[model samples]
Target: MKQQSEMILIGGGLIGLSLAVELKLRGATVTVLSRNQQEAAGLVAAGMLAPQAEQIPSGPMLDLCLRSRALYNDWTRKLEEMTGLETGYWPCGILAPVYERPDCTTLPQTPETPSYWLERDAILHQQPGLGNDVVGGWWFPQDAQVDNRRGLIKTLQTAAQELGVTIIEGITVEKIVTSPDQKVTEVQTNQGIFRADHYILTTGAWSGELLSIPVYPRKGQMLSVRVPDDFKSLPLQQVLFGSNIYIVPRRDGLIVIGATSEPVGFTTGLTPQGVETLLSDAIRLYPILKEFPIQEFWWGFRPETPDLFPILGPSSWDNLTLAVGHYRNGILLAPVTAQLIANWVLNAQTDPLLHHFRSDRFQTLR
Candidate 1:
């Protein structure tokens, strides 16, 4: 019998934990080193799996997102079955409201899931609580969301652990010890040295700290609110994409409002200005939001690359794989990212999907 491939994954965010689950299910001995789960961006994400609503242009990034969005249903279902925890996979669709008449040509409409423009009256009927400023909107029926904070992140962690994936939290990775032959021999962490046959860097936002990758932190501030018990249903039934903010309604009466994308490096804490801006914008998009009580205020760092695409596939080291720089789509892209990376690790099959996201794309820029 062939010996199982031993893999050590750095980072235990949604991306890391998802990949760990995939690898372990494929019969690999997987160990994940998580610096801090609370600091992980996944825990703080709004978990909007919106490819069309995000208006990503037709390209590799869009393709990657669409593929991952397609995989979310089965992925979350299997995780739910395995862990008996609901991931809050709500395929309630997304509504991108606009104040002015939107130019149809500029819209990112794909054949897989076409977005239709809803006139003022039609949009108002869809969402009665929408602010008067919303003249019209594009309705992406296929776009959906998951509850990251309350559902997906915890479910993924549980599923990973249940599948025999060893997760060691609070251990910060100090460095990757590589052999002279350009292969990772072991990883040096605050806990100790851990050797593995292969290593994966899923360290979002901090990928550059460990290696020469272009991944960096893009800080975002977000908050959630709870609907009053008197309401018959959620004030907002669908995810509302406003000009500068988005309002996501949860099944459990908690509504998520977010975010401000500041290129502030690793700087933490939610600013008063950030919270104010989000609240004002959210209220403008959905006037009824003013009645909701603020539940939480938080922020997280998105692992962003220079070109705004993920840095995936093999690194310069033979045994090291790069799977960072997911930016705002970390939760949306977790399923597909795990599948692609696991295939490469277990079968050495490099799918053509990884062509655009290769780590070598930044070689010239570096």
Candidate 2:
């Protein structure tokens, strides 16, 4: 029998864990090295699968987000079956409401997109929890969400481990050693040196520290609150988005409100201003938030790129691949990314989407 290829993945975040599971299912021996499994932004994210709502001015990212959103249903379902864990996959759609009329001016009008401009009466009829401040809203019926804490962090970890993928927590890769021909050979880590035939860098924000890449930390602060007993069953059935804040309702009677995007590098402090902004905006959208008890407050660094799009696919090194720089949409894009990276490693097939997210796309700009 031919020996299974050895794959060492650097970074145990959502992307890394998903890739590990995908590669392992393809019969490769995969191992994941992470600094600390608890610190990834994927855990802190609100897990909103809003593709049209998070659309950039214009780019391939929206298309990519939509593609991943389509795969989420099957992906989470399979993960649940494999690990027997509830991933908190909620297909309850998203509502992007604006307090002022100007906020609705930039809503996209793509022919194939399933968004509708909702008037005040229609918005209130659909969701009665809104405050009078909401003038209008954009409804994306296809967008969905998952509980990152349970669905992604715990679920992905459980699924990866069940698939025979070794997860080394609290380990750091100091350097990646490649052969003279630019093929990855081994990684020197805090624990020891580990060799593998293939290396995947899914280190997200800290990706630049290990590889020569442009990934940076975009800090985001978020908070969660417990829904009152009366609202526990339904507690805002859909995700509500305002100017800079978004409100996500979990199935377990907890509502997640977030987040402030600060360009401060790698700093993980929750500022008074950040918390104040999130609560104030959240309460503005739904007055009932003031009656709820605070659940949690935290922050995480989003792995961002210059173009605000993710970098996926192989790097210059033949045996190394780059799956970092997912930014705000990492949770939404994880499944598709895992599939593409695994396909490339197992069959050397390049998905068309990889062209838009190549690691070296910015070489011509310099």
Candidate 3:
């Protein structure tokens, strides 16, 4: 029997696996438990690190996203060297396209906030495939994406093994057994008993359901389609947004159309309504995409907290940590979350944002 662990991470998803790798690199003996065939939320994401584009105007989420965006280049390079996997990390930047409705009673806009405003003629010039009545947009040069599917799998499974971190899959953790001091002692699984000195949960949408996190699942159904042979003639130069819809194009000739946020807990299957909404809006935004053939269809859950941000940092337990509830931003935030968790573990300091996402925030709502 293993006596005790330097650390044990749960959920084998992006955050769990990334943190495990970081900890092991820092000399901690780490083990990651990944269970089920569930695509492990991060795997299904378009992996856009677009804080500047998705900026919520005001909140801790904006700051967290910016901090994470700042880390992408270095993080992707490190993962690539170790696993020889192309993370497809493109720093080509993102464009936040704006649509205007000709409102008669509206305040003047602020240009310093990084948004672009153009009339139909200019929009047609910039994006030849756009529909009529197009307005201008915002540009986020820092927003980028990783081929999250490849990145998560290679980073967690392949890179983790290369770094000597143990991965146990398909085993459900029944309970977290702890010492009298209330530190995480081990996790009991259906397969067997695995002991550890500390535990971190990165279970995504399953985080709250597993351990009463103030979290829930927000499902997004997305699809990928191949662009036309002449895709390059009027190809999208940046990630695009029209109204509430977003179209993300990859270098591999795959243009991804996504995604509607629905509150259906833990259900992976896509509904007719979900698919209709996404496809309809996608075609409306980029008329060229309508001619492309559909390549893949996917549905995933974003682990959302009440405040729509991740609940990270120390738990009430001496050695337990909360690194879940990242909701839609998990893929964007994974690397930075791993780095921050590693820093907290090494320095024993609590993140200031912990006050906002702490489990206690929900008791008041109840």
Candidate 4:
């Protein structure tokens, strides 16, 4: 008989949903179980799709990012075609202003790209309210973003429904029960029994509670302020880069300012200090943002790995796969992750990305 076709995935966030979409497209039956809280986080994240603009220096992490960036165009197209969701994916560009002298240190100008290193006059012309004090900056027209909140939820719910993939809500996965041979036989859930041939854990920050994968919660605080309709220029067309913090604008006039990367041990609270820091920094970068009224103040935890990249592929166990600890790049890396995992589920040996991120790295941990 052919290999069993049912693939059960835990965590209904972008990663889980994207994987379901990929697998369903390839004719595999997929089921996604998402706890309410995990589903909500996807409804709140800022979906930045910039790898070159967001990659931090050098490492295996940067390589994963660049590869993911290359895959996004094709991935988004399929999702849009299948689900008919726009996904708000824009590859327009990113603007990194250099107002403070330290701004250059954070997001350095790429001399290779002449369009970067924008003069103050040009920045003002391109973005009218860019704090006239700015001197120069970098511009990346290829970096992109999506309205992550809408894109994720719509994709998950719609894709699952349209593609005949099952989505069970309010089902919190307890653990992956493995056999003596290191094969996952079943997933224990708060609701009931779920048996599967292959189990994937993509629970983000919560993955640590279920699996000892070295994934931790890195607290990130965000501010959503509602800008006035009559406000001067499009305060944000590109994901704005700045000295300390950055801003992302949505179609509904809600601009997001973020974030503080605090390892607060899974505490997702709304803090005054966090709010002040994001708001204050946003104004420093774009004086026009100061004119907006504050709307939402909140914080959440990002699933962080020591290597700052997701661990994919089969777990130490035979049938359990790990897909957590994406840290800051979860949204950016979702498309490629889905493709890689979907391939792993089918081919079992052809996924090079799987071998690259396996937990065997922990054996060399020092």
Top candidate on TM-score is 1
Query: All candidates' lDDT scores?
Result: 0.89, 0.86, 0.75, 0.74
By TM-score, the better pick of 1 and 3 is 1
Q: For residues 1-366, write the lDDT of model 3, one tens digit per residue.
A: 343566778888888887888888789899888886356677567777777677565567776777777788888788888888787888767665555645532223334234454456665776677765456555555578777775555755677899999888897888877668768777787878787667888888877766766778788888888867864553876777667678887787777777788887777788899888988887777776778899888887878887776888877677888899888888888877888888887777666755666666667678
| lDDT at residue 44 of model 4 (Cα atoms) | 43
Q: Write the per-residue lDDT of candidate 4 for residues 1-366, one digit (tens) a residue.
A: 112327888888777877887888889888888886442345446777666666466556666776787777777777788778877777767787776544344443344222456677887777777776688777778677777765655755687689898888888887777778878877778877788777888888888898877888778877788878676755577788777687888766777777787878867677878777877787877887776788876667788788776788877888777878787788888887887887777877556546668877876775
Off by over 4 Å in 3: 1-4, 101-115, 230-234, 351-355, 363-366
What ordering of candidates by TM-score runs from best to worst?
1, 2, 3, 4
Which candidate model has the greater TM-score, 2 or 4? Answer: 2
**Candidate 2, backbone clash total:** 0
> Which 10-residue window in model 3 sums to the lowest lDDT?
104-113
User: Which candidate number has the best lDDT?
Assistant: 1
Give the Å error, residue 317, model 3.
1.1
Per-residue lDDT for 261-336 in model 2, tens only?
A: 8899977789999999999999989988999999898888889899889999989899898999999999999999
Rank the candidate models, highest lDDT first. Answer: 1, 2, 3, 4
Error of 1 at 212 (Å): 0.4
Candidate 4 versus the native: TM-score?
0.89
Give per-model TM-scores. 0.96, 0.95, 0.90, 0.89
Instruction: Give me the displacement of residue 146 in model 2, in angstroms.
Output: 0.6
